[model samples]
Target chain A: MAKKKSESSVSTVPSPASSRAAGVAPSHTDLLRQMLLIRRFEERCAEAYALGKIGGFCHLYIGQEAVGVGAISALRADDYVISSYRDHGQALARGIPPRTIMAELFGRVDGCSKGKGGSMHLFDRNINFLGGHGIVGGHIPLATGVGFAIKYRGGDQVCLCFFGEAAVNNGAFHEALNMAALWKLPVIYLIENNRYGMGTALERASAINDIAERACSYDMPNEVVDGQDVLAVRDAVLRATQRARGEHTPTLLEVRTYRFMGHSMSDAASGTYRTKEELEEYMKRDPIIVLRTTMEKNGEWSDTAMTALDEELKAVAQDAWDFADASAEPAVEALTEDVYVW
Target chain B: MPVVTYRDALNQALQEEMQRDDRVFLMGEEVGVYQGAYKVSKGLLQEFGEMRVVDTPITELGFAGVGVGAAMVGLRPIIEFMTWNFALLAMDQVVNSAAKMLYMSGGQFNIPIVFRGPNGAALQLSAQHSQAWESWLAHIPGLKVVAPGTPYDAKGLLKSAVRDDNPVIVLEGEMLYNTKGEVPAEEYLIPIGKAALKREGEHCSIITHGKMILVALQAADQLTKEGIRVDVLDLLSLRPMDVEAITASVRKTNRAVVLEEGWEIGGIGAQVVDYIQRECFDDLDAPIVRVHQVDVPMPYAKNLERAAKPDVPKTIAAVKKVMYLDQ
Candidate 1:
């Protein structure tokens, strides 16, 4: 948890907009700042989990930052988003305050779910971020239903559902995809294929090597994009969202990324399942570094700017930690509230 | 008053609610084109159109989860399982998603959804197809469960459950669907947590819900011939249970007989027994007795099925035992 150095070397690179790619958002600085803030916030979470400040299954979004930043960047604020448990990155990118996410992780009243839902289940209705669900593939059908509601009401809004590669084999996934396809619901099913379902590798779990090909079973369009590349992920998601909004069709997208940390804090940097060489290989394509290197090479970023932004975000994470630490546990009487709405 | 089948009453409730609100829609297998497997939704597809009266594949969990998701975004969905037995596949969405969404979201989203369908044994369906789901479904804290035995209660409870602003399980009586009852020709809504006095008496109280109301009434009739009058209380809703009504009935009669169509252990009768013991123990003149389906998988043979099922004779015998009429 010390100050980390930049991993990507600066070279000639194209700007986000020029390649007609999902490259970067309109502002290079903002995209860089957003992804870095998530990195810093969750690094603190890892530290807290180690110290027992945060409990339960805490999964960090350490290495796979670009997929969240760029994909969410393509979505309008009105669009709905639902994610699996490794959700701090997407929640932060969706513009939910770092303090709220941090507080929820700490199990405080100020948390989005008022501490009723700990690390796994985070919900914010105001921003249309549906939730961070716990069950593996259980939420895919829920997302498809959100799309059904949107279409039923004739609303142009779409939903982006995030899940891991591990969820593909689940019956819920297949069933949801089939319905989403049959009904032409406006949902973007984004698979963050970090290559492991806990300790089991994707190759061991799935029959097909290409996760996006599973979409063919439902006759849905799909894309396989570089999850490490902010622009590429954004571009693919932007196209998917366009298809969703304009045509009311669903798309399945596989964002190939890697989890730098173990699946959860219970497992360390995952040396048991993976090798140092493989870990180093994925570490080189780290999302933050990939985006920063491109921007710096384009003369849109600098070492001074990166250092200043890093400090600012670190303070933000610290303030969030302080807020969560100061917030009280939920009142005892609240135990029975919200079970039913009279 | 107009005499109508329970299925017709339920149909009227769905038609009225859908006509009243644009957000309410029905989704299930065979609900639209086939007009419901039990014909509970007959003529609905033609009236409401295919969009509102939807038919999904045999994906119980898929459609059920879809209903939960749709409900989260402000639409009121009525998800019908073909039977309560098939709802086992959809319990994940019912229990995990619809029931817990509000609490888990810190009270942000109230899943105003209703899961409705026929429940309990019908003839000799036996085993997998025949299950009285009230006990298991009622166990969930976030869900409001209701079982209506009469046509009047069915119409009113289904209408109310659609608007309850929480996940509700409407355990419709499969056998009672074809049975005729006098329903008032006017609008009415039955509150989800009250019991109805089907027949009032003095010697004892017979508490039941759904189809067991008929058994309780029949038993009460024969008991009257034996100079043993009893009060038959029909518990329409299980979760926001009408404990006050139960206490009043048990306190009045001084003896209680619980009748249900489900298994004995951890049954609805057991919960009622717990409530009665805690509330009306001193008032009781005799130990309470329960008449429920025998503690075994429903047998397929006609004789074994009739023996396993709790019928009017079982109810009468249970009441007589509590009243000390039969040694």
Candidate 2:
């Protein structure tokens, strides 16, 4: 089919006054750049996976970039961020260096986890990125505990926990939310409703399709936002974070998004479970394209600027791959190390 | 020195640790207003208030993960599982999350937490509630397992566990809770991975821990009356397995009899036998013997429960058999 006229008009140029009135200064451009960086980074990762440079389970964040980049933009440096296995974007959005994350995926000594945790487990304690836990909903409880620790220490800092939409069915999700609500812990449970958990669609897996409504049982404030829109997610998460920091209230946020690629590199991007039409439909609202169009239409950005930015980000992603390729494998003696502190 | 029951000793250790460190807090079912199911945390809620002394819901996996998360961020959380049997619900958190976080994070995180609760059978509590899990926990590499047999060891080990910068599992003996022993009022900490020799003898050694230590001692007493002097070695720590102490005692006695309240398969006794046979193989004058609970679920009937567990008679029989005595 054909592209709609309205979709083209949405990218029409805007006046300088309108851009200023929208307050699209540091954010709109920055969010676009970050989302582009993640897109390019994940594209290179898929190539690296095919080349056998990166091993283990590699879950890409191709389409859900806006959810991670947007929500993380609202967080402070001192606040904590935890997410599920598809965390390359979240880690990059949380400001973790691309080189370190790439090296981790390469299983090299310079990796953040020193080659111990492969792609599925990326961690940087310095930035308070707890980890990229592999288990479906295992980290929910841990995130609640992080909120508990912050509250116990009398800190206004909030923790943002990201998981797949399917995690709502996990007992840990319910138990952790109940505890967070009962204790009034400062935590925001962000669900990246990416339509499918691996191959199972959300509707087939969840009895209640509206995940945000499930939080009401625990008396938590919640919202469902357009995850493909970076600004929308950023605004919603900012409001929730403010409430968490101000009143020590926990919020459940369900970001309605879709993945462009299959679950992982192992999955064939075919129409076995999902229809080709569904992929094409969601591709129309690609987060990077949407954000770039919005910025370009507002006159805050240009085609030449984005083209130059894309080249720069491609170099950055390439530099990460080069650094990972040149890095040394962990020493044999290091195998037994880090098992225990003592 | 002050004479206190094992339960009071644990309570004192928690109170002292919480008083000493502001980051140390307690959370579990019935640990606050209910004062603990076994009253092990008696009077703590009144002193520390609800924040430090938390009363968690019956969601073991949730709170246990919370304790791990809290520990990750430098809060020393003492997560009490009502019993080791109930801890099965949270094994994912205990074994998978807490035990593997440090290694998985490449030494970035140190889980400075303690999972404490009464372990093993306690007077015919039936199958579900009556199970020992020391061996199961000790199998994990990143965890430190400590079982205190007496009031003095209980207080000392617990204090050390709280201060240790790693995940420690303190398995208290339910049957030994009311048993009293002399505990010093002065600040003391019994180093972990060290065993205490309760009674020294020349004929054979009775190596045990937890409630079985008392049974071993009683068996030693009975063996003394029958002219068989058996050494009683109490292995307070299971994971680190006080190999030096076990080897030294086995070398001296030239024979060993291991005792445990868990099943025969993969019990602490099995570990001891492996260690003794490997290290003290040539030093042994006779084959090492193991006395453990019968290989079956603990029955509710009083007589069957007594027959199912490792008692003084079983210990005495093992010691006598290792000494080459008939009957």
Clashes found in each candidate (C-alpha, N, C closer than 3 A): 3, 0
CAPRI tier for the interface of model 2:
medium
lDDT of 1 at A156: 92
Off by over 4 Å in 1: A1-25
The prediction achieving the highest DockQ against the true structure is: 1
Determine which window of 10 residues in candidate 1 chain A has minimal summed lDDT. Answer: A7-16
Encode model 1's per-residue lDDT on B93-197: one tens digit a residue.
899888998998889988999999989999899788878989999999899999999899999999999988999999986798899998888899999898999
- Give the local distance difference test score of model 1: 0.89
Candidate 2 per-residue C-alpha lDDT over B1-327 given as tens digits, one digit per residue, 9 for 90 to 100: 789999999999999999999999999999999999989999999999999999999999999999998988889999999999999988889988898888888889889999999999998799999999988999999999999989999999999999998899999978889999999989899999999999999999999998888988888888889989888999999978899999999989999999998998878888899999899999998888889889999999999999999999888888878888855
Give per-residue CA lDDT, model 2, range A103-165, as digits (tens).
Answer: 999999999899898888889898898998888888999999999999999999999999999
Worst 10 residues of 2 chain B by lDDT: B318-327
lDDT of 1 at A85: 85
Residue B128, candidate 1: how far off, in angstroms?
Answer: 0.6
lDDT of 1 by residue, A1-342 (tens): 234323221111222223224443457677787788888898899889988889999998888999998898888767899998888888888777777788898888999999888788888897788888888988899999999999999999899999999999998899899999999999999999999999999999999999899999999999999999989998999999999999999999999999999999899785788998899999999898898789878998878878877877777777778789999988998899988888
